[model samples]
Target: MYHNTKLTGMVVYPNDPEYQQARMNWNPFTNAFPIVFVFAQKIEDVSNAVKWARENKVPIRMRSGRHALAKDFSQTNGGIVIDTSHMRNVTLDKKNGIAKVEAGIRVGQLVRMLAREGILAPFGDSSTVGIGGISTGGGITAIQRTAGLISDNILAVTLVDANGEVLQVNACENSDLFWAIRGGGGGNFGIITSYTFKVRTAPSKVGIFEIIWPWNQLNEVIDAWQRWAPCVDVRLGTILEAFSKANGLLHSQGIFLGPAAELEKLILPLTNTGSPIKVFVDEVTLLEAIDFWAPNEPLFDTQNTTWSSTWVKSSLPEDGIAAIRTFLERASGSESNFFFLNSGGVMNQIPPQETAFFWRNTRYYMEWDASWTDKCETQKSIKLVEQARLQLKPYITGSYVNVPDLNIKDYGQEYYGDNFERLRKVKERYDPENVFNFVQSIPPAHICDEKDIDD
Candidate 1:
């Protein structure tokens, strides 16, 4: 009956000349050889791809920017990848202070477009991460404490459900679905085509700061940052990173919605905590700050990347700091490091259980990133991150669904917290057949009760 929704996307099969480029994933460590790839250009293209995959008995993997962090999350061997990468479009409503953004638009492109109009929203550090993933996964950014998460800003979404039916989800309609989509993770309940987000006018100028210290200052820097970052002024949002010993550096940077002198005073405790080799502070327009944070060229060019993130409820103890030093000392790859995105302030003002993003009260977000240029070092690189995660397990509780780790035993609870059960119920209501299945996807209540046989 729905055959009229024919597949109109550009399909690239295994034999296609561009197949290699088409199949590349952001985390090359988890690359897959899908049977075919569909670069969907419109909502009809997405609907047809989903229906065709179901009819053909081919597993479906919905990808926004190929940035899924774990194995088989966004790409699957012998299955079809229905990608929204080509569907970049946007409609701004300055009157309502909102925007209708296509799911496939990259963060950098979207930020630039909004900056041109003197508006912006909460976004992640990597300019290449797709808006669909970042928004649904609960975006992290330098302005999070001041602006709130990207999901918190979402007003509505137009998504195609697993049954080839498009639904409008928002606060007043399909409200349960809206709550689940906010932070339940991307490509879970459905494939969102576009999102209506609350956008704010960009500040003409904001203070930015960057500081670096010698590798030996790891303990001092982490101790100072974790103690100060989450409690600092509400106008500031920052990140602390400890590079591998081979790299020999500790970097901290942030965006402050204030003047340079004001930020300088706020960060004095941190700047004075450790012996910093480089310290710089300046005031720039919001657009300039975005550019300063982003890479000059497009991102996702790195290969063989392994990444995972967790919710930090409290400060990491001294033992935790030592563990990081120990791991970096012998980490196999030069790209291994620890990343901490500040939390608290306005972001934590919202209570948990309000939305699917249950880690609203987290002190900070921690991530382990490991990369290797040589393929032979893959296991070593991944293991280094794994070892680090195990060491910090006591200090960290939940994991970010965006940076999935297959090694986690019970991912449902880890990712969704108590909201996991609620998410399952929503899944049953919208996708009783469990059509959108991934490695760590939330299974409907029926499937959880052992009444199902296949994914």
Candidate 2:
């Protein structure tokens, strides 16, 4: 059903050699085949692609860094895929501390460019992730405890709406669209061409802390952390990342932002709670720390792994921790444990209702992930993952929309929570025709009556 017409940007088809790379995303399980691919070069190219897809009744999939690991949400079989990779453009203004970045810019690329000019924007932990996708779905960064979500620093955005009209929106202009793009969801309202964000001076020195604890002592460590991690001062950002070790040891990597002596002071309580197998803390430049936190190289080649996330008020209770230990210990040990990123510092200081991101009161946001390369072990990983979820479901307040599992039956409850209705109204006012549609994308209020059944 897609038209073969080409606009300003180049178009690729299924037979093209680059098709495979174009259709690929961060999620290994997602392999899609769109009828055509638009390598969007300019803002007008994006608008033309949207208009073309709408007129041809073709489903459109918007992609930036392809970091969305969820299936269905960004996948479209035999549909039209709008590739934003070619639209890379960055403008930096040191005098005003503002940077205008095209949606296609990668986190690492942005950091490298800004560091040259003595400025940096707060973004996700990964370097390859595109600013476009992360900003729309509750962007949390290592510095989030100090600076808040990436959306919080956004000054304005230029979005090409469903009607093929480019609208420059911000707090003072097209405020509703601005609200939706901040935390509602990307690809639902429009294709953001560029975003203007207030940048800050990069921290000259940052401290990172890593520790490995025995599996038997996880409860003591997590419980102790639950009480102390949230109360840490705003200058120090901390995270309790739990993971299984290849050497048969369970590890908890704690990342901190401050001097080495200061980091030691913050982690002394955790060390006293449980003896760790190995503990290392050091100070590094902000750029070097970002490289240290970037995902490993082999990660780029792995496929078929599953990731899920949910926000929690505090550490999982004793019963919840016991359930997790049981699941991780008995479930083949192939799956990694969840993480409680401390989010109660500057993150909580922002009022819950200020922007679309509503987890301000929550002490921690947890990411449940299960990664495996063996096709046969998929079932084992999935079952154990579900077991972990079932145990922690009662304690979960909400899920991050970006890291959702397509298999989740009720998405509204998992992602948007109480803000679903308000998001629906924003969608109605901006994308009434559903021209900007994806498999699990939010629907406008007028059309939500039909789609709500699926939710």
Candidate 3:
């Protein structure tokens, strides 16, 4: 009964030779074993897989690039994992400044392809992260201030819902679903198979700079960066990172749409703040700037790590900066560090209630992660990340959905903020049976007494 002709595509079973490799996650900490993996090569394959899963009564999890930070974010112990890495197709409409892309394309591949046409699409730091997974959860990139989030650039999407029906969702049709999927988290409302994004023109060369200060100057650097980054010229996008004491680094790097001379002039306030060890600024190709910010190799990465993040409503005071320094000092691994992204400009032009992304008034986004290679260091690393998040809760407000953390109890509020309740209602419409439910997946709205649902 389950061998339906529509269930087409490469399927890997538990006993298959490729099953072990196919089921591997980008993050090694998320240990899971799925019954099967349906590698979707087309929209029909996605539809068929959903129908088959429904008949077989198997829970389904959506996976692409396998880079979900939270455990169980993209896989399950005894479920069907729909892996959409085979559908890498794109149609570029340069005249209209639009790019229609398949769901499985990684951020790096897409950006490079568009760069050849002199088009700049918003993308994240990692080259291997899937656009579907990240964009659906509000993709943040270095150019976010100038271009807006990846979600904001989306003009439309092709989705396969819980009922095995393919639907075209946009501002006109299925409008509510359109708003919900943008920044509401992927696989919560439906399976997005393709997206049409509004891209922008790009200069052949832009200003790029990297400045580093001694580890001891981190506190002052943090304070100076907080004041300057968020309010910098919209043409420039900035990021600062503080490595664990073991690495002894406090680096600030960014890109300016103008020449290196202009960028250098714009960043004098930061350089003049404290004693600096090294400063470099110059004109570079957009691809070169993308390569410079990349931390991991442009390939599927496997590492044991735990991550937690929150948005800053205001600048962190001296005490807050001290707390960040103290917690980061506990990290001993080379990969452990605290990262920051300046927020504002085009990303904030839309108010909170306009879309599922609610943290529009944020100053910057901050996240601290702990990494370890030794099995002996696992517990300590995870515990440190959790404790660090709790300690810094006073300084941060909302959590980032793409960078999921199971430790956050009130995840609905933490991830979606004021948009949580409306997201629940959209979940009620598209996935009323909760067929796509997971740890932090939105649940259908409950029509009951307010008292019964109070936290």
Which pairs clash (backbone N, Cα, C closer than 3 Å) in model 1? none
RMSD of each: 2.0, 2.5, 2.1
Q: lDDT (CA) for every model shown?
A: 0.86, 0.75, 0.87
lDDT of 2 by residue, 1-455 (tens): 33563455888888989787777776677667789888888988988888788778788788788777766566588788777877779998888899999998887778777866767667566778888888887788877887788888889999888877899999899998788787787788988988998888876777877777776777788788778877876666566755653324555445455687888888788777787888888898776666766643332436466667787786677898787667656544444666677777778888866777766788777776667777897887777777778888888877788787666667765677777778888888988877777667787787646546366
Pairs clashing within candidate 2: none
* lDDT, model 3: 0.87
- In model 3, where is the ten-residue run with the lowest total lDDT? 446-455
lDDT of 1 by residue, 1-455 (tens): 34534556899999999999988877776689999898998999898898888778788998887777788888899998999989999999998899999999988889878988999677677888889878887787778888888888899999999888899999999999999998898877989999999999888888999999999989988999999998998888899889889999999999898899999999998889878999999999888888878644544557677877897888999989888898888766666788999898778887888889888888999998877888888788778778888998899989998888877767888888889889999999998877888888889877765323222
Model 1 ranges off by over 4 Å: 1-6, 449-455
Clashes of 2: 0
In angstroms, the error of model 2 at 266 is 1.3
Give the Å error, residue 186, model 3: 0.8
lDDT of 3 by residue, 1-455 (tens): 44553557999999999998887777878858989899999999999989888888889999777888877878888898887889989999999999999999988888988877889988777888998899988999889898999999999999999988999999999999999888999899888899999998988788988899988888989999999999999888888999999999899989888888889999998889798888999898877777776544635455588999999989987778878888779998877899999999999888888889888898999998998888999889888988888778788899999998887777888999999899999988989888998887787897333432332
Model 3 lDDT at residue 157: 98
What is the alpha-carbon lDDT of model 2 when measured against the actual structure?
Answer: 0.75
